[model samples]
Target: MYLFILLPVILYILIRKKSFKKVLRLHKVSPQQIFITMLLILAIQPMTALAARIMEHLLGHGFFPPMGDMSANGSGNLFMSLFIIAVTPAICEEVFMRGVVLDGYRHIPLWKTAIMNGVLFGLFHNNFMQLSYTSIVGIILTYVVVFTNSIYPAILMHFVMNALSVLMEKYPTSLYANFTIWYETNMVLLILLAIVSICATILLLIWLKRLSNNSAIESMDASDNSIEASDALNHTITFVEWPLMLATAISVIYSLMMVYAM
Candidate 1:
């Protein structure tokens, strides 16, 4: 976690001409925007699980084991668990992925940038199980950062999601027991929740699209000169960009090795 932040800062100092604030998108967003970001994350939770299940089915069980033996030796302390699993990654990974790496590709179209950011994030995990879901989450976080023009929303969303995971893992046996009983007792409610999640997710995407469109229009109106510069900067690059290509290749190769070795 510390390395993520530190490496990015070092690279920025050595290479990037832009100020850290601009590169990292340390801008402000409205309270309502933050609330919407939270709602969007809630809506997407079911979809993320679905993506993970799909990946697991395609890759098979052997490809992914529980990360870090968290189940065998649980954190025991709630605050420590939260600090290790939630707070640290929320800050460090976001700083590295969304702040440094995503910013490196900002000259490209937003969708392409988001997709690349997602893929890189997935590979960064070096595990099949996490790759699919984390990629999806990364794309969503990238979109949120780009649309809101701020990093706080992504950080908050990451923290919330990680905190939930920590809770789930911290008391897995208890949670599983309660879930089994609840499923047996309230199958109808479970179905309803699933249906609601699907519907809410669709609605949130529509809402986000409209919000993004409005923001784009406002940005265009605000500066024609900036738009021209943005367009000029949006040209494609080749794989001859050795640094990016090499990093991507290494990540993919290592992940494949881990998968097969399992």
Candidate 2:
């Protein structure tokens, strides 16, 4: 996961952002939109998780094993693990998968490219049970990156979704056991979380719609500014320095291994 995910990301952000200002300008994302997206990540994650679970069962899998193993260590190690899983992936994966790979295919029909990118992302995961569920999540994220044209938005969304699952996993099994009890134990906490998750879903939907409109306006303005440049501008990454790519690959792999090695 580390080698596959991060090496290309560091290369893209450092190389692409510098070389391709037009790519950066393709999506107009305001500060307000970014904040709302961060909030929505906290809100919509549980719903997304539930959705993934349902898909697993529908696909004949009982439950999907998580990509991030929460209890791997750190009885109190939440902070460190959060860095590896949430912060690192938010940046690297977004840059590599969405920014580089998805945008690389911009010439294809936009929607098709987005969905295909999402499916590819899902398959990129090592976990077998998560393939179907993560694919759905990947599709949503792909649309997000395409519409906004910024990895920041995608990274923010990904962070929120991941942090929550880590928190849940780090919780004492004793505490969660109560919630897991079918008849009556920890239902209250789970119920409250469910409510919070639903609220997050609604807010996320609103935020996405708002972003959609703003993006449309920005695209129109851009098109008016240039009939030819819009078409002339390309999204592919070429001639990336090999050194940056190699360093990034080593850093990400070492970081993840050090964190998860426990």
Candidate 3:
């Protein structure tokens, strides 16, 4: 599935003769941006968990249970699980989402691009329960990519989220596990923590965006404002197409069946 998601994006870049570096935004970002991206990713987790819980409650429990524990005893199995669950999706999914899909929507306004990309990303998962929280994660991931103007931050975000789950499961007595136990038991505290973390995430994102905007302005000032460049930035196009519509319909129908069947 990871390769299936990524291969077409690579081929499209090659066929279009676009620079891989530019398409993937492989340029470096500042330490400050990297730090904030890490914090933003961590801060949003509780809220995302809450969203997923709410979705499960609505869809019924065990709708999408974990296939098996990633916390196997052997180091070999652990590494393999991490590679399959975390690393592969982090690279492949980020390339498709933030790399190609985002570049395709560059003509749209920033917020529009982020929201649409996020929604499409959630649907791409084809799981109703995941769609609830992954959409939220996707929006934040898009913002991280956009603000940093580098795909690496988004890749890190994806890896950290998945890897943490694997590691925390491996070490059940970890601080994160203790916190999860308490948080799940206390409804009020869970709500309060989620709200606080969400606010922090927004503040951090705004700061990152401010820094990104400053950098963008400086770059524009340094560049020759060629007609071609201006046209590319100003270009607009209809976002609705048959492929996306078809995919959305299929995912919706499949998710509905799964939700009700179980």
Candidate 4:
């Protein structure tokens, strides 16, 4: 249901733009920077598990996210987690949350819109444990959406993050098994992720500023009527067509099924 509902909508967005392109590359993230960005996220995972284990060990309480039924060896869980965590959410969420709503709210300041909507995205997860983690991630994702002014980077990052989780779970103990475990327990990766995110953000900001100076990121024309920025809502499919409403209905039903299944 989730897939059925979201596939068309994002496809519509992709089709909206005559062409699409990449924004940022984290892998090309120099070795020195990788260490900085990935260190904290990698380190904290084990501690989170260990802490939770210790708490349960002492108090007979193993607390987990109500919304997250993740485990090391759950059957068929890998693909499920991959799609749920990565692809579907990436497209649908980016479109609705960052693309549509945030864009609509451009009436507010951009930074303010990014922050406020990102917090809303986090809360949309509807879980206490996930609230903090997803909020952090939501903010990061929102910034990337804002940074690139495109959703592809967010989708790529989201897909990689989720697919990596599946890969690590399958091959749990290896020479670099630490990385896998780090993601399974998100906190481990978060420390390094935070540092890297911060640095990347600073770099990205500088890049955006440079682009602005050159009018590369958001180009302007000679005429005030022609603000050549994509941010300008020059075109929109606001006909209230049947497909749009049908898609919305399908999305609601799909959401209901997912919640029902959970």
Candidate 5:
């Protein structure tokens, strides 16, 4: 938690010349936009799970053991768990990944920016198991931040996702036993569920794109000509300089070592 805050602050001071407010996108979002983001996240959960499972099967290995196990440790304090697992990560990770790192790539195309942000966020975990799904979630969160022009939605979504993970861990058998059994017994149902979730996610993305377009139009009307002209051109993907490539390579190597060591 501390590193997340400190590292970003240090980087901002040393490298990023942009204002913290602009870099962090600490703007307000409408209640409706928050609701839509939440819905989109919920709709994509099943698909993400399926993707993770497929990745696990292809790799022939299970996920690395979690650093901490709340249930196993008998950490029955709900408030503490929520604070540590959900709130801290939502605030700290967003400040670093979506705030500082993302701002550094503002000159690039939005899609490229989002993908790079997601990849960096995934590698930041330093675990192969989390890299796949977390990257996907990161991409979605990046899109949300870009479209809404606010970090609050990304923070909220991250919190909700982490909270759900905590809850599922706490009540794994009780909460999902029936669904797990049904899924195992009925392949068709599992496939259908994945398909439906993916379709819903796609539709929500389309809706979000429309909302982003409207927001961009409003921003253009309110802003100066320089901003409008900057938005008009798509930037090339030359943002991956040597330093970034070296850091990413190191992260991947570290993650592989950790995975094998486990």
Candidate 6:
């Protein structure tokens, strides 16, 4: 919480001397917008699952367990597990990624910003198995925040994704599990399903973008730009910064250690 949430808030306040909410992109979004965002994330599941499953097949099963499963055990109840595995990360990570990180990259074009944000997020995880799919999801989440001009939709999307994972983990005999069993055996079907899901994901994203309030997004951008002249800390940080470099190096070393240790 301190690293992802509080630290960003402190840095924003110290630098911008402005309301952290604007920098955090905390604009309010409509209910329909959030619902569509949830659907978008659900649509993305097959693709992400395919990425993870393919990597798992290549590396052998039991290599990189789901972080949620690692932390949430049978000792925890459903609510506790959900809170630990889903809710907390949704809030904390969204605040850091979609809020602080995205805002920092505002000067760049949307596509570049989203991709870079996604890459950073993937690297943040430090696990080779998760890097691809999480980066894809991170890109989608960044676009979610950008389209809706709000952080809440991304948070909801994140929660739904993780919560479903937790629920599925809890109930191994669920339909999803059955489907996964079948899916693993059918390579042709898996590829077809992944393609269809990707198409659906594209459609959902376009629909969500159309539903977004353009004026609000413009207003937010203008609001931030308006303050740039007076705010000395408005400058963007390059990737070469010592803090980012150090963090990346640590993550890589840790991931390598885990791989060799296993």
Winning candidate number (TM-score): 3
Query: Candidate 2 on 1-262: residue-level lDDT in tens?
Result: 4565555444556765554444333355888767766666555545555555555657776563543454344344788878866777777666666665654454444455556666666655545566655666677676566555566688777887766567656663655433433312234554566578777655665566566654533543454445454454442222123323443454456556756865
Highest lDDT scorer: 3
User: Among all windows of ten consecutive residues in candidate 1, which has the lowest summed lDDT?
Assistant: 234-243
Cα-based lDDT at residue 137, candidate 5: 85
Q: After superposition, how far is residue 253 of candidate 4 from its true place, in Å?
A: 7.4
Write candidate 3's Cα lDDT for 79-101 as tens digits: 87788778887998788778877
Write down the TM-score of every candidate. Answer: 0.72, 0.60, 0.80, 0.54, 0.76, 0.78
Candidate 5: what lDDT?
0.70
RMSD of each: 5.7, 7.7, 5.9, 8.7, 5.4, 5.5
Q: Candidate 1 lDDT, tens digit per residue, 1-262?
A: 4653446455654684667777678887777787788898777765566566567668777433553454333447777778877888788778777786766665455666778888878878766678888998888888777777778889999999887776666665786446633643454654565567668855765565566533533443344334464445434442125336644654565557656855
Error (Å) of candidate 6 at residue 38 is 2.0
Instruction: State in Å the error of residue 6, model 1.
Output: 3.0
Tens-place lDDT digits, model 4, residues 1-262: 2465355545654766522232111113333333323443343344344444444446554344422455322445767666665566666665555554444443334454456655666556554444444555556666555544555555555566555555655566864567644553565454555455556655654453343332222321222344346744542232223333543555466667768877
* Pairs in clash, predicted candidate 3: none
- Residue 85 of model 5 has an lDDT of 80
Task: Tell how far residue 68 is off in model 3, in angstroms.
Answer: 1.6
Q: lDDT values of the candidates? A: 0.67, 0.57, 0.73, 0.49, 0.70, 0.72
Q: How far is 152's C-alpha from truth in model 4 (Å)?
A: 1.1
lDDT by residue for model 5 (61-137), tens: 87535625643333777667878788887987787777767766665556667788898888787667878888888
Sorted on lDDT, best first, the list reads 3, 6, 5, 1, 2, 4
